[model samples]
Target chain A: MEAALTAGIGTPLSRSAADALNSVDLTALTPGTPAFVGAVERVLTSFFTTRREIVDPLGPVFVDAAEALAQFVVRGGKRTRPGFAWTGWLGAGGDPAGPDAAAVLTACSALELVQACALVHDDIIDSSRTRRGFPTVHIDFEDRHRAAHWPGDGAAYGSAVAILIGDLALAWADDLVHEAGLDPAALARFAPVWARMRTEVLGGQLLDINGEAGGDESVEAALRINRYKTAAYTIERPLHLGAALAGADDDLVAALRVYGTDVGIAFQLRDDLLGVFGDPAVTGKPSGDDLREGKRTVLIAEGLRRADPESAALIRTGLGTDLSDADVDRLRTVLKDLGAVDDVEGRIRDLTHSGLNAIAVSTTTGPAKKLLYDMALAATRRTA
Target chain B: MEAALTAGIGTPLSRSAADALNSVDLTALTPGTPAFVGAVERVLTSFFTTRREIVDPLGPVFVDAAEALAQFVVRGGKRTRPGFAWTGWLGAGGDPAGPDAAAVLTACSALELVQACALVHDDIIDSSRTRRGFPTVHIDFEDRHRAAHWPGDGAAYGSAVAILIGDLALAWADDLVHEAGLDPAALARFAPVWARMRTEVLGGQLLDINGEAGGDESVEAALRINRYKTAAYTIERPLHLGAALAGADDDLVAALRVYGTDVGIAFQLRDDLLGVFGDPAVTGKPSGDDLREGKRTVLIAEGLRRADPESAALIRTGLGTDLSDADVDRLRTVLKDLGAVDDVEGRIRDLTHSGLNAIAVSTTTGPAKKLLYDMALAATRRTA
Candidate 1:
């Protein structure tokens, strides 16, 4: 069934290579490890194929939309959530070759679907035009509407269709988890984790939007948003879910959560830094995109608090404005001079250290411990 | 837990009277029977209370949002989906006093949450201001944003928040089903039904928007959209889901689906008529709102097809445009004169007849058959 569903989707990348990594050496399970990433990609391909079949009778237009969603899922960013989940499962003494391994992989791959829903909806909410060097779903739809000379407001049509598409992605995410063939016992344990992760992420989004609308720029507010919005779903819950799936004890689960929270915050802090300073070529967005959007990140909050009065005024005025290259450079210099850049880097180091240390002291399997440590460094120190 | 959750939420209507409905006699199980409606209400209340606690720590604003959501779920239009599901269960010989009754109630009540998600998102997509005599979620949020003197565009914030709220409701709907404690075998049977209903409704919505944007006017297009958009989720799938939960055989499930489809379509036909000619005070909108919005419903499609050239030209010109009250009256006259109203009424009668006939022949429980017959009538013939 899996093979049939994935037929004509390009061949799975290096399954043999991935399978080879499973032989004798379990320590090679770091984040974005190709072995697990390949397995996840195959699971996603099969899932989308099933979805495409479900929507086929709706008509060519709907079929096209489903295909677009499928393509969007199959292509793009590092599968960080799944990678962490793999490590967590391994850390909990779950054997990759065990009978439950397939079910575990299927279950964890669901995080990617959730991520797809988030990015698709978030793009619509933020009115982002591009992502990963391609037009965002709404923008793509808007372009289609205009090119076809369709009646009505193109932008409204775009947003409306994108809303449905995002909704479809979300519904499909739940479906994938339910259909993953997890045993009833495992499913029962994983249910609340799934539920809480969903609510937490959405609640975090609500808080972030509310803060933006209310002009809330407190460092505390920013940190709180980061913990829920990016941290919990992205790392903490995925790890916890993996551990629970393996029937790991509470001690290990709690320790993993501690590690997850620290690492997740560090991940978001890295994101904040990248949002302002990363090259457009690497980030697929203009430099200082967050600043241009007046996003209230922890880095920005700290800069506001620490800068001199004159520099603070400059930072405030430059935010949410259309800045030239030179102007962005000027703002960058000010932030660096204010020591905000160094402060954030220092925080990331401290958080990563604490997170790794937690894992170090835990009863995590030796192989997964090394992988988790490697994942921490990669997550915080990546260029994009 | 249920009582505590429902405390301070106002008393459920006539629980004892409803309980009496289960005494030896079963024919009292008609759609919207107070007994089942009250139970569904209690389930929803408890579900929302749990959600409120989950979001409480987020702050008072979020708490208010959750409260508003809970209130909206409790106070609204007839609980039609739950009513149908209950009838389906009864028809399949489900025992109202059985151990599974509460679980079934909890499971079926999820339809209400799905409906909540649909209405909230639809209001945003259509930019509707009110529903069922109350301000729509987006409009309510927009008002709050304005009153609070928030910095961003109030409309954008309203739509964004509504999107997240809809997402939450959708997620909670799934959680309710998972938490309902349905046996694994029952869950397995019900999973596909639940999954399909979600896809069909969202797919229907995509079709509706596509029709509007692409100027699709064929009666075929109109009927197809109506079937998937309103009929499937609203009636057919709810019955199928309930029957599945009750472990009904496929033959009975098939019979129920046929009845559901016919009744569901008839229900939408009535709705289309109401859209054009219902009393504004009763429908909670100005007269001819659908005509003004130029919704491409079956009634409108038939009108365009059957009218004389002059009347056709008139409809083409008037639809989707701002018009005076006098102009609306003129359009109403043209539609009536074109026999469009009679055409739709004829369709409703025929559909409702076939729907009731399906139940008449089925091996459905005597009481449930009677109830189903009554529900078919109420669904097709009601004004609001």
Candidate 2:
């Protein structure tokens, strides 16, 4: 079933990977494991469904926003964040299928809700029209505004509405987390990670905005942004939070952090590559769209550093423009010529190897550990 | 300091009012009261200061939004929500000076932060340029966008940025509340009120938007909006949540609800009058602005129902326009001529009287009761 959800399931390597993942005895170890996953799935589905229902009570303006977010959230990507959280919980000797496990999943589910809110707001900031093969919230709302013949600019109204709805989602996420019923010590342990995650995400967003405006284009600055924006929240903090909840000691948590950091950065680097080169049908976004938005990715910075003066000028101009197909092809050629693509691919290999090594050396070993290792590998090695 | 805070306190004139409130002894509070009050004050002051410091971390793009929200929130408005929560805790026979008191105050402080988030977003929804004599967050951002040579239209970017910041604030509010260390039962007790408050506020906003856009905005509909939008969350929920935490019986809770409902409506009605007629210095708003904005207040609805045909048309056009001083005066005169102002005043009196009556027959009594009674009177009788 998991293989069927993706595009290239029949390839020998892909099939093997799927088999390896599925062969892990997720349900056999303890009844609690399946129960935890079940609880998370049930609660998240209910939360989002109820959210959809409640939003309509605010009338048409909110109805449009609720519909947009519902589609955005429900389009179904791999629930990697939740998976990582659950794995961490189990790897740290926590119960897989009990209430604590449910707590981990609940926290994980809330993280996705937070991600949804962040992405919706980010799309507005970037002015992108599509995400996950559907119209972005701002764009959807803007279209509705125009369709309804509202007096002002539909885009502006739509953007405004999207922002408010995103805020609502963020608020609701907190509410869900608080009601997760974690014990006091667990709650306290999780609070700092949660707080830091928010601050880091906001800081990362600020860095991204600043970089777009040519404020921080250095490789070092770009790496700093990646650490806060992608690395911390994506893998490191989630792992740390889950382990802490499961009563992992400081050294064990530190080991997980190292693994998470590498994997997180590698995952983002892969995404950067996919954003520029992946097939649209697979990635659900247009190739080279990130380049058109002039995101100050490490790949772009490296390419510029290696390019000739004239080519460098081309890269600079291409940073924030809506590049045509021809423009994207030219940029891709320049990147290849500069060897930036090879450099990024090499980094991805190193990061994946490092992360795998961390997991191997750690004292933890179980079905959950195996699953984490497989997930980290798949996350970094994906082509799209 | 307490004396200064409660100077010129008036006694309940009615026999029932005096009897219902006889249990309160403001002077004989428990030993921990001072410490609890001090902790809350310290936390609140630090929270605001920290908020101001962190708000503009990305430079001037966010500075205006930060400043506007800071000024609006830190100004001399009564901290009634927090006060009510604390008082309710006391009224329910909880120790006024214990850790519970601190917990209640912390929870109450979180409400202020939530309110700040809601108001900032609300301003964007309403498109009001000024709030409390300062430019609204969106407007501030819009002005900054124009002032700076940023990419897109300043207004659009401003609105987008404002929305993101509001989301941030909302998220932070929930974070604070969750970290307050309230026990599960305490948290659960407060959950429904918290949830309903959010729903009502959002629903009220929708009703306001729909009503202004020429929907079926009957007087009955306007009253419903008033109850949901202003009354429930603003007073009733805060009081009820506090009382519930104190283990107040159903009768006590119900009595507070009756009192809160009446006072909350009266509070908004008085605000409508002040919106049109109060001094700018006192109200922190330009006089007659509400007339220009064409807020769908009960006063306006009443005026429309009673005004002659010619006056009604003029009022309709004036509802959402940027009215000149002469236009505002003309509309006010027409409203007065139709006796809508008098009608609203009568309603306010009735509501206040009913609220006082509810308070008179209540079984619960304490310093908290006296404080509540005073607050209800002051809220309903306010001129500005």
Q: Give me the candidate number with maximum DockQ.
A: 1
Q: List where candidate 1 sits over 4 angstroms from the true fold.
A: A1-31, A279-285, B1-31, B279-285
TM-score of every model? 0.90, 0.82
Instruction: List the DockQ of the predictions in order.
Output: 0.32, 0.14
Candidate 2's error at A213, in angstroms?
3.1
Over the stretch B336-380, how does candidate 2's per-residue lDDT look in tens digits?
999989999999999888876776787657666677778777787
Q: Clashing residue pairs in candidate 2, if any?
A: A32-A97, A33-A96, A33-A97, A294-A319, B24-B366, B24-B367, B32-B97, B33-B97, B294-B319
Q: Across residues B87-178, which tens digit of lDDT does each residue of candidate 1 receive?
A: 88888988976777667767888899899989999998999898877899888988999999877699998888888888888888988888
Tens digits of per-residue lDDT, candidate 1, A1-384, equal 113222312211112212222333333434575765766787888777666545765677788788888888889767988877877888999887677776777788888888888888889888889888899998999999999998779999989888888888888888888877789888878877788788888888888888888846778888878888988878888888888888887778777887888889999999999999999999777888888888888999999999889999999889889988898899889989889999999989998988888789899999889888888888899898
Candidate 2, which segments miss by more than 4 Å at Cα? A1-41, A48-72, A142-153, A306-309, B1-41, B48-77, B127-157, B279-284, B307-309
Predicted candidate 2 versus true structure: per-residue lDDT over A1-384, tens digit per residue: 112112211111111111112223333432224544444445566565555434544456456555556556656455556666666767788775454554555666677777888888888887878877788887886776677665655665666667666765676666556556577678667766676567557656756665665455666667667766898778877777777678786656666777777888889999889988888888777788888877788898888778899999999888778899999999999999999999989988988888777777776647666877787877888877
What value does DockQ give for candidate 1? 0.32
